[model samples]
Target: MISRLSRELSPHLTYHSLYHTRDDVLPAAARLGRASGLNEDEYLALTTAALFHDTGFIDTYEDHEAGSIAIARAALPDFDYSPAQIDRIADLIAATRMPQRPADPLQELLCDADLDLLGRDDFMRLNRALLKEVRHYSHRPVPDDTWMRDQLRFIEEHRFFSPAARTLRAAGESHNRALMRAALASTNGANHAAGGLA
Candidate 1:
C-alpha cells in the first residue's frame, strides 16, 4: 500500500517547490515507528500518513489537511480502514494546526515531524523560505512582525507531544524560543529606529 501510494504520487510530485526535501520524510517516519508503539499496520498507516500529509499543496494551500484527507481516503478505499483508523488519520492531520496541542502519540509524531526543522541549524533560512513560499503560493503579503507574532504564539502555546519527541527534540523548543525572542527584540528595535527617523 505504501509503495502504491508513493508510486502514484511520484510523477505528480516532481514539480512542487519542496520536492527536493522529500527524502527527509522517511527518517521521520522511521523515527515515529521506533519511538512510538506502532506495529506493522500502524507503521504502514504512519508511512501513508507521512506521504500524504502535505499533499494539500497540490490543490490549494488553504485547508490542505482536508485535501490530504480526501486524497488518502480515495487512494486507500480498498484498504478498508476502520472508522477509527480513518478518524485517527483525519484527527492527526488536523493536529497539524498552528497553535494547537497534539492529543496522542501518533498526532505528536505527525506534528513534530511536520515541523522537524525547527531545531535545525538552518532554521532561520528555512523559515524565511517558508515565509516566501506562503507569500508566493497564498498570494498574501506577510510582514516580519506578523510572522514573528504567529510563531511566538505557537511557541508559547505548544510543546512536543510524545516522550520520544520531547526527549529527542526538546532542544528545538529552546532554539525556537531564542529565535522568537531575538526576532521580537529586533522588531522593537526597528520600530524605535523608525520612530527616530520619523
Candidate 2:
C-alpha cells in the first residue's frame, strides 16, 4: 500500500508524501501505542488505521478521511480483519479529520500520530513543505502572516489526549507553540505598522 502510494500519489504532496506516512506517522503511532500500553490487538488496529488514514488523499484532496474509510472497508476484509475491527479502524481514521475527536484510547493515539509533527523538531520545515503542497494543489500562494496566524491558531487549539501522548509531546509542542506565537505576534505587529490592520 505504501509502495503504491509512494509511486502513484501526487508529486505535489510535499508534506503528505510516502515519507510522511510510511516513515514518520507509522513509527510515531507505534511509539505512542507502546507508551500508551496498548495490547497487541489494539496496537494492530491503531497501526492499520495509521496505514490507511490518508489513503483518501489518493482520490481526493479534501475530505479524504471519508474516502479512506471507503478504501479501508474494501481492502481490510482481504487482510483478514473482521467487520468490527474494520469499523474501529475507520473510526480512528475519521477521527484524524479536522476538529479531531477521538472517543477511545486507540483513537486518541491515532490522533496524536496524525499530528506528531506539531510536537516534532522539524515543525517549521515541515510546515513550509505543507504550504508548498497547498500551493501546488491550489495554485495560489498563502501569505506569510496568514500562514503563521493559521498555524498558531491550530497549534494553540489542539492538544494531545492520552497521557502517553501528552508526556511524549507536550514539551516539544509547547516549544513550537511559543515559536508560532512569537512569529504570529511579529507578523501582526508588522501588519499594524503597515496600517494593514485598518
Candidate 3:
C-alpha cells in the first residue's frame, strides 16, 4: 500500500510524502498508542487511521481529509476490519483536520501525534521543510515574517490533548514558543528596516 502511495503521491506533497508517513507519523502514532494505554482494538484502529490519514493528498492537496476518509472506507474492509472499525478509523483521520476538534481519547491521541512536531526539538527544521512544501504547492513564497507570525499563532493556539504527549514534550514545546517569538521579532525588525529603505 505504501509502495503504491510512493509511486502515486505528488511531488508537490513534500510534507505529506511517504517519508513523513512511514518515518514520522506512523511511528509517533504507535508510540502514542502505547503511551495512552490503548487496548489492542484501539491501537489497531489508531495505526490504520494513521496510515490512511493524509492519503487524500494522493488525490488533492486541499481539504484532502475528506478524500482520505473516502479512501479509508474503500480500502479498510479488505484488511478484515469491520464497518464499525472502519468508521472509527475514519473518525480518527477526520479529527486530524485543522481546528482539530477531537471528540474522544482515540481522536485526541491521533490529533496530538499528527502535530507532535509542535513539541519537538527539531521543530524549526521540520517547519522549514513544511514551508518549502507550502511554497511548492501554493506556487508562491510566503514572506518570512508572515510565516513566522503564522507559526507563532499556531503554536500559541495549539495544545496537546493527550496526557502522554504533553508529559513527553511540553517543555520542548515551550522552548519552541520562545524560539518562534525571537525569530518573529528578528524578522519584524528586518522587515521594518527594509520598508524604511524602500
Candidate 4:
C-alpha cells in the first residue's frame, strides 16, 4: 500500500503524500493507540485506519475520505479482515473528515493521529506543505497573510479529542498558535508598509 501510494499519488500532493500517511500519521497512531490503552484488535483497527485514511487523495482530492473508505473496503477483505472490522475501520477513517466528529475513543484516537503534526514542533513545516498543496489544487498562489489567518483560525478552533492526544499535543498546539499569530501580524505589517509606500 505504501509503495502504491508513493507511485500513484499526485506529485503536487506535497503534504498528503505517502510520506505523510505512512511515515507521519502511522507512527502517531501507533503511539497514541498504545497511550490510549487500545487492546490488540483495536490497535490493529486504528493502525489500519491510519494507513488508509489519506489514500483517497490518490484518486481524488475532494471528499477523499470516501475514496479512502472505498479502498479499504476493497482491499481489507483479501487480508482476512472481518466485515465488522472493516466497518470499524471505515468509521475511524470517516471520523477524520473535516470538522472531525469522532464518535468514540478509537475514532478520537484516529482523528487525533491524523492531525498530530498540528501540535508538533514540525507544525510549520507540514503547514507549509499543506499550503503548497492547497495552492496547487486551487491553481493559484494563496497570499501569505490569508494562509496565516486561516491557519490561526483553524488552530484556535481545533481540539484534540483523545486524552492521550490532548496530553501529548495540546501544549505544542498552543505554541504553534502563538507562532501563527506572530507570523500573521508580521505579514500584515509588511503588507501595510508596502501599501503605504505605494
For lDDT, the strongest prediction is: 4
After superposing candidate 3 on the true structure, give the runs of residues whose Cα lies further than 4 Å from its correct spot: none
Q: Give Cα-based local distance difference scores for all models.
A: 0.68, 0.89, 0.89, 0.94
* Model 3 vs truth, CA RMSD: 1.3
| Residue 66 lDDT in candidate 4 | 99
Worst 10 residues of 1 by lDDT: 12-21
Q: Is candidate 2 or candidate 4 better by lDDT?
A: 4
Q: Which one wins by TM-score: 2 or 4? A: 4
Q: What number of backbone clashes does candidate 1 have, counting pairs of residues 3 or more apart or in separate chains?
A: 0
lDDT (0-100) at residue 85 of candidate 3?
A: 98
Clashing pairs in 2: none
Off by over 4 Å in 4: none
Q: List the residue pairs that clash in candidate 1.
A: none
Over 44-87, each residue of candidate 1 has an lDDT whose tens digit, in order, gives 66666777676665576677778878877776666787767776
Determine the C-alpha RMSD for candidate 4 after optimal superposition of all C-alphas: 0.8
lDDT, candidate 4, equals 0.94
Could you tell me which residue pairs clash in candidate 3?
Answer: none
Ten contiguous residues minimizing lDDT sum, candidate 2? 1-10
